[model samples]
Target: MNSSYANKSIAVLGAGESGEAAARLLHQEKAMVTILDTAEENKLRKKIDALGAEGIRVIADLAAEHESLHGHYDYVILSPGIDPAVPLVQHFIKRRIEMIGELELAFEMCKCPIIGITGTNGKTTTTQLVEKMLNACGVKTVASGNIGPAFSAKVNESSHLDVMTLEVSSFQLESIRRFHCQTSVWLGFAADHLDRYRSMDEYYVAKIRIFENQTEDDWAIVNYRDKLPALKAKKITFSAYVPDGDFSLREGVIHFRGERVLAMSETNLRGSHNAENLMATLGVGFVRGLSFAQMLPPLREYKPLPHRCEILRTVNGAEWVNDSKGTNPDSVEKALHSETRPVVLIAGGKDKGFEYDLLTDLVAARCRSVVVMGEMADRIEAIWKSRLPVANAGRSLEKAVELAHAAAQPGDVVLFSPGTSSFDMFKNYADRGNQFRALVQALPS
Candidate 1:
């Protein structure tokens, strides 16, 4: 009997990257783990074989037997893609079966210090940036949690970094109880994942849990403007304009308040949003005694992560960007505002119940034309029709790219910064970005 699984049978729901990694880890710990998914065995045969080779049980197309399976298993480890309120989950809840996300399980297994990061927009960038700066300063660290490797899979004894910097999503933070971070950074929060939580307050509360287990000695690095997180943790504020905290980009120079450190006027990463991200990472470094001078090289050379303002290529003097990481209205607004030139924007996907009008207002103010795609394109097109030329790609990103590129003029920017998730058309933002780049490269130069 494995005490980690409470000496009871455990089921892992879903077989994506996180689910597979989690199942592997649970099996390594000698837990009686079973992997389940709705897809037919033929489609998931590869994953099933992999799990079977690893001595883990695999089940597929068991929708009819889901209730019975839940009743049998002691706990169900849910993948983030699955909704908490869905009928399958409600059945488990009604049956008194326990459920937790992969992050929760990972937190339980890893003994190293965890630095959890969460926000609507900048979590991935900040997490990677912190990992880079920390590595430069001789800290043994890895960036994992949401978009990359499962922290549980990355855990090893020989690991050099003393701390693990995690880019935790709201979904991952929902079930964490004992996952305490020595340093927690709440970059900023906005209305996101409303579809999952059913309300903004629930979403906010889930993200707020990043600092719930932190002691008074642990620091909560936060945005100066975020009120909810500021009240919860021992606060360390980082801002772009404000000069009071550890780091700020005042006027043009990137300044450090504590040590009077400042970077050169320009950086490799574009936009003031990047400036804010750099500031937050710098603050994290300063508190840890990581020299600002050591981090400056990576800071100067660090490139923006894909689909979040990744400049793909400039053709005919027009810059084409794959900002597919903009999966919400606020992110798209930031992407649009990041540039001065009128943008030929690609925006839409599975709607998360945010106000599309707010996005249209920004597009009207800056976008020259919008190439729409995905399930919610019609609604987005309706909002921006009056202000900008709205062209429908009818849910095809390839067509959307063609339309946007054709509409874009010299000195104009073409950006695929959709204000919604990529599930409607692709696996995630990475797939969307890959497809965009492939199509863009295939285009005649």
Candidate 2:
């Protein structure tokens, strides 16, 4: 047990995966820990019972206990799902109680250097790729943060890791104070999380916090396309369109510092977005003194993760592609551009306060028709009906898939790439994607 945290009172907000992991970690450190969540006690009974067995107090229905929590902690461990603007957070702020995210708390305890990856999209894919590449090159590393298990859960085993590839989200970065990454990769950025943030700038501010504590010895891998502010760390740029960066795609091959590195043909990664992800992964390997030869095995063997432009099945000549991970307009735009065949796109979900008008031109050019669904179906149809054929499937993802399949022709792609969150319908993107795969597989030949 760490003496610094011994007997320290800590409140962990939101008893989700990250919160439970944080509570466990704090308890192991001998802290007086309490887990608070807004969910009903019945819903989280199993989790509560497990934590209670470990001597950690869990208070469900946080709103009812909010008043009782005043002045009860030395610090608060905020889960990523909880908004900072919530009254409980505001109360903690008013009292000057130091609040940090699970990511930050994990960083404080992590013994290994972290390679933090953040972007509006491709975060999970890139994080997985970097972790695979590093481990293949004989570097002991693990991928965590927003991807797999929470960073706090992995901190206990950090001593065994040479480094960690963390998928950092803007939400996790919001409350970070001293969190720093040895190699920070800002893959790319676009408007997202508008519902949680006041404006795009506010969201960008949170995302760029990955570089807040970097020193000269550290590295920042960024896209040349994104205009970033001055940073303390040495910056390495990568791009799929431009050839001027330290790493870039020129012709069909990827070049590093004007030298040939790897050909795009050698890897299974598709799309310009993935090209950027590959380059960023290479940049991390470069910083770690890994040779292109050493990284090629993992890079060559890597395949796209499910739900991100994953081709599910073919009915006649039409391909059913699941891009359910495409949760924002930018991601949908990329999915559209990646397809060579005309797409019958199934889009729309819970609106995140973004305008679908931005995708109008792209949709008109790349899609044969559009099928909208979930809460934003009407709004998406309203935005695209004038420019192209649009059908509203309301709240049924199955209906959206049927509509898309009906609209698809031979040699065309039936793309299910919802441009908003999955909360309005299914449990999450994976659930949405899994159901999509099942639905598409069930379609009559």
How many residue pairs clash in model 2?
A: 0
**Top candidate (lDDT):** 2
Least well predicted 10-residue stretch by lDDT in candidate 2: 62-71
Native-referenced Cα lDDT, model 2: 0.89
Give the residue spans of candidate 1 off by over 4 A: 1-8, 66-71, 157-160, 229-232, 241-245, 258-266
Alpha carbon lDDT of each predicted model: 0.79, 0.89
TM-score versus the correct structure, for each prediction: 0.92, 0.97
Model 2: runs farther than 4 Å from truth? 1-3, 64-67
Using TM-score as the measure, the top candidate is 2
For candidate 1, the 10 contiguous residues with the lowest summed lDDT are 1-10
Alpha carbon lDDT of residue 93, candidate 2?
Answer: 78
**lDDT, candidate 2, 266-287, per-residue tens:** 8887778888899999999988
